[model samples]
Target: MKSGEACLHRLVDKWLAPATVLSVRVVRSGRMPAQRARFVYIEAIAPSGSRGMFFFRHQDGCWRVFPPHDARPSLCVDALAA
Candidate 1:
């Protein structure tokens, strides 16, 4: 995985483990109009039936997770190892 994806993987593994991840969906994604940075909006669901959304922006060769513009979650839980 790329460095950005690797960051997300570590985050998910560190905090979201033990819970089965149901899905991860991209809500929005694109590059900055006048910059090299890229942004992505993502949503995730868990087997427990909880769901949330988050935003990520790529900068300095890394991906940083941020709180959504709205009230959705800032941390997205990816698939946890079964």
Candidate 2:
């Protein structure tokens, strides 16, 4: 968790000074064992006073940043394009 926090700060450093984590929420989808997937949702406030969100998935016994599309297939790629 610490490492992930550090990484998030670095990632937002260009646009925002640093990020202060506001909340961390863990969620699991599906009731069936075979369909279950765990994810961590992070809400943060940037030094510039803007809010941001980050999503990570449990894989290989560790949480890692996952693609937004993988996290939610409903999101449009065009809207998220840089």
Candidate 3:
């Protein structure tokens, strides 16, 4: 299995233990313009008939849970240069 899939399985296991995973699907995938990072939105269903969604982001060459923070424009001032 791919590393990302394995990581996802681990995450699901950690969060939803005792609940059998029925299905997993990638709802969306794309690069975040701000961070220029790849991300995947997933939807999972458990045998207990509960559904959950999560966002997995690719960062530092690893798949991690939660999307990266949005980048906001900020002003930078150089007092020495002024």
- For this target, which candidate reaches the highest lDDT against the unseen true structure? 3
Which parts of model 3 are misplaced by more than 4 Å? Answer: 1-6, 16-18, 47-50, 69-82
Candidate 2 per-residue lDDT over residues 1-82, each given as its tens digit = 5554535434434333343644333333322243254543444454445454443434444433553223444777898896
Given candidate 2, what's the lDDT at residue 67?
A: 35
The residue-by-residue lDDT of candidate 1 on 12-64, one tens digit each, is 44444445777666667776565545666555667676544443554444455
Model 3: which ten-residue window has the lowest total lDDT? 53-62
- Cα RMSD to native, each candidate? 16.0, 12.2, 5.2
Error of 2 at 29 (Å): 9.6
Over all chains combined, what TM-score does candidate 2 have? 0.34
**For all candidates, what are the clash counts?**
0, 0, 0
lDDT tens digits by residue: candidate 3, 1-82:
4655637666756664444677776778788787888877666677667555565556555566677666687777785568
True-vs-predicted CA distance for residue 63, candidate 2, Å: 1.1
Distance from true location, Cα of 38 in model 3, Å: 0.6
- Model 2, residue 81: distance off in Å is 46
What is the lDDT for 50 in model 1? 50
Clash pairs (backbone) in predicted model 2: none
Candidate 3 to native Cα RMSD, angstroms: 5.2
